[model samples]
Target: MKNMTLERITEVCGGVYYGSEADKKKEIAGAVIDSRQVESGYLFIAVKGEKVDGHQFIPQVFEKGALAVLSEQELSEPAGPYIRVESTLGAMKKLAAYYRRSLDIKVVGITGSVGKTSTKEMIASVLSQKYNVLKTEGNFNNEIGLPLTIFKIREQHEVAVLEMGISEFGEMHRLAEMAYPDICVITNIGLCHLENLLTRDGILKAKTESFEHLTPEGTAVLNGDDDKLCEKKMVNGKPAVFYGIGKEAKLAKTEQGEKYLAEKEVYATDVEPVGLDGTKAVIHIGAESFAVTIPIAGEHNVYNALAAVCVAGKLGLSVDEMKRGIESVKTIGGRSNLIHKGGMTIIDDCYNANPVSMKASIDVLAAAPGRKIAVLGDMGELGENEQELHAMVGEHFEGKGIDALFAAGALSENLAQAVGKCSKETEVHYFKTKDELMEELLPYVKSGDTVLVKASHFMGFPEVVGQLTK
Candidate 1:
């Protein structure tokens, strides 16, 4: 809330300030766009969303003790203080960007095809060991969401881990402009947003846009295991920190090799998976090595942990701090979070799915020690070969030792059929809708089965998980 006041907001956003000239200097306690969230001393911005025009709630917010309002249209002799701007959302973003620059904190901006949220959580968890941290909450990682997330950063916060998500080229540039990150982290470039970014290389180019906005001395933490990302030696002229898992024999061959060389790097060896309990791994940083148990399952999470360690090391965290941080890191819900209910284990990873993430979740399901039942839904924005992609996912299920496959939505029908053609051992069922799937889901799921529910967010796969868990 520092430098956030009626006067400061007007100056930052270039708005026409009206009424209570004396109140201009009064600091607004908070900023919001929704009238229902209005609190005492809050500044409410009237954004005209697709379904709702927030201007209708301007009077309501003022009545609820809001200090001022940002109006997209000029009010006719307004009774309360207001700032009239062409667009409220635009002004809100500008104000947030200005406010971000005013703060003396290191912002670690996270982006990639997968694991943006989980990696943000991991990095924030690790950085919290030595600093007062504020991370992006919920789905607040887009243009509007990113600014709203930035508004939550107060004076006490020493580090801000902001996750930046984009579906196209310009989106990341816009997000990066507001975030102005000190350390930009790319988890990996995968086949996501192929509707716009047509290829994995295109995804990489769009994601790395965050690096262009990094501080002059900023660092890039990359996943060295990703083929697309591993080759990059520098970003925006600054050398990046590369981390990955490699054979122990290769660790000693650091003889001026370009692939092995990095500005700073960390890798893992002796990675031992302990099923649902989590993973035990020995992380190596130069000569220093330590064994740590990451409190999460999946080999992919090992990379997530190493990425956190790389960032932590860059920020001056000691080995013990990194160990504690990695151990303290928790799995985020809908991003491979494991849940046990009614004698069944549900891998509630139905948040978002790409070809890469879908396969990763199946790999997690493959590791479970029970009859594996996968409930898959449609993956969105996959471009021209959407059906082919769904079939590819089914091909993954084929002979993978899956006991049952329940697919819902239009695209997933292809998945069920693909599995059917490939194997008779796996039972495949298809549903036209989530409701239809729910009707027959319970009977197919046995008590001892491991259910993996996953799909893109639009498919409403969580409703299916809800039915199974209920």
Candidate 2:
């Protein structure tokens, strides 16, 4: 809320301030776009969303004791201070950018085709050891959400871990403009947003834009195993810090076997063990190490831990602090959340999915001790290669030792068929509707089976996750 006075906000956003001249210097306690969350002295930004227009609730927010309002449409002689902008969302971003500048906190911005959220959680956990930290909540990594996350920063926070997600060109630039992060972490460049970015090279271009507003002295931490990210020349003329299981990485894994790595600096190859009930890992970073166990699954989580360790080390957090913070990290709602119910274990990863993540989830399912049943739905926004990608996912299921596969959505039919052709041992079923699929699955799933449900957000596969847990 620092430097969020009406006069300063108006100056930053270049809006026509239409209110009492005496209230120009009045301060706002907070900013919100949702009327339900509005509080006294809060500035309500009237954003015209797809489902609901925020302007419709302006009067309600004013009644709730809002100090000011930002509107796209003009009001007929407003009662109190208000700012009229051509676009309320744009103005909100501008105001947020200005507010972000007022804080002396270090902002660590993370982005990638996959694992951004998990990596954000890991980084925030490690940094929270020594500092008061605020991180991106839920899927609030988009333009609107990023601004709102910035608005959540309080005076007590010493560092802000902001996750930046983009599906098209120019989105990251806009997000970075508001964040201006002190440290930028690119989890990896993978086949996501191909609808907008077109190719992996395109993905790299879009994901790396986080460096656009980075401070000159800021660091760009990248996945050394990713061919695209590893080839980057420089970020703001500073060499990129790479971490991965490969030899070229500054923080590479050295331990033997599938799970444990023994090398020095934040290696995922170290023995980071997770029980069937939850996640557990011990990470080594530059003359320091800590054992952290979380309530999440998948080997990919180790990389998330590595990214966090690198960021925390850069911020000067001690080894013990990192250990405690990582151990305290909990499972996020939709991302890789493990729900146990009725003698079955459900890996509810229905938040979102890509080819990379789909395969990773399969790996976790393959590791489970009981009969593994994968309920997969359509993965959206993959451009012209959608069919091939869906088939590739199906092939992964075919090769894995999964007991059964239930696929929903138009694209997933191809997946089911692909699995059927490749593997006779696995039973593949496809459904056009979620109701149809659930009807069939509910009767087949045994008490001892382990179910993994995953798809993009649009597929609404969380319904399957909910049913399994219930």
Candidate 3:
């Protein structure tokens, strides 16, 4: 809220200030878009959303002790103060960008096809060991969410780990303009948002747009193991720092089908999976290396830890601090969170899914002690090859030695059919709706069974997780 007085805000937003001259010097305590979140000294930005226009709540927010409101329309009636702009959403972005430059903070902007949220958490955890870190909460990684996350940063916060998510092209560019991160991290390029971004190469291009907004002296931390990412040897006029599972990664392929090799600056070695307990590995940072026990499950998380280490190294965190940070990180509710209830082990990764993540969750379920039961639903935004992608997941799950597969949603029928055609040991059941799948789920599972629930956000798989846990 520093340097965010009404006069400064009006100038930053290119809006006309309509208030007494004395009130212009007053600074806002915070900024918010929701009328319900307005406080005594808060600035309410009135956004005309698809369902409800925020202009209707402008009077209500002012009644709730809001200091001022940002509106796209002129207000003639009684209000403490108001800044009238052309567009509230656009003004909010400008306000956030100005406020960000006023603060002396180091930002780590994280983006990828998948794992953006989890990786942001990891980087925030590691940076918190040496700095007061503030990170993006939940799935607040989109156009509106990114600016809101930036506004949450205060003078008390030294480092901000921001998660930037995008479905189409140029979204990252707009997001990164406000962020201007000192350290930019890309988790990996995978089969996600294929509806808008057609292929892996297109995804790589869209995700790397964050690099354009990096500070002149900024650094990029990339996943070296990804062949698409490994192709980029330099970013922002310097060598891009790479992190991965091994010392060297297979670079882009040549015309003759051969691959070049490049060494990773920050890499993990001797990665040993500890089942549901998480993973144990050795992280090598520069000439120094140390042992770490990542509390989060899945081998994919190791790359997240390495990215955290790479960012921490750039910020000058010591080895012991990085190790403790890696070990101390906890699982998010819908992303790789583990639960034990009703004599069953449930992997509650139902927040969202793609083919890569679905197969990764299957690998986790396959490691459990009891019968592996996969309860899957449809994955959205797969573009024209949606059926083929669903079938691809089915094919990957077929040979995993999974005991039974209970799949729902119309798209998942492809998965069920694929599993039915190849696997004689596995039982495949398909349902037209989640309601039907839930009806049969409880009666089918026995005690000591390990179940994996996964799907895209639109499938509402969290409800499935709740029913299973209950």
lDDT of each: 0.86, 0.83, 0.90
- TM-score per model over all chains: 0.94, 0.93, 0.97
Which candidate number has the best lDDT? 3
Report the C-alpha lDDT of model 2 over 1-470, residue by residue, as the tens digit: 78888988888888988887788888899998899999999999999989999988888888899999998888985667799888889998998888888899999999999999989888887787788999999889999999999999999999999999999999999999999899999988877889999988888888887788897689988876666776664788987776765333343332232333222234544444454544566566665556667555676777777788789889988877777777677777677787778888888889999999999998888878789899999999899999999999888876678989999999999889988987777888899988899999998998889888999999988788878777
Give candidate 3's whole-model lDDT. Answer: 0.90
Candidate 2 pairs with clashing backbones: 255-262, 260-269, 260-270, 261-269, 261-270, 279-294, 280-293
Ranking by TM-score: 3, 1, 2
- Please give, for residues 6-80, the per-residue lDDT of candidate 1 as tens digits: 888898888999988799999888888878888999989899999999988887888899999899888876658
As a whole number from 0 to 100, the lDDT of residue 397 in candidate 1 is: 73
- Quickly count the clashes in candidate 1: 0
Query: In lDDT terms, how accurate is model 2?
Result: 0.83
User: Judged by lDDT relative to the true structure, which candidate is superior, 1 or 3?
Assistant: 3
Distance from true position, residue 409, model 1, in Å? Answer: 1.9
Quote the lDDT for 438 in model 3: 92
RMSD of each: 3.4, 3.8, 1.5
Clashing pairs in 1: none
Task: Return the top candidate by TM-score.
Answer: 3
Is candidate 1 or 3 superior in TM-score?
3
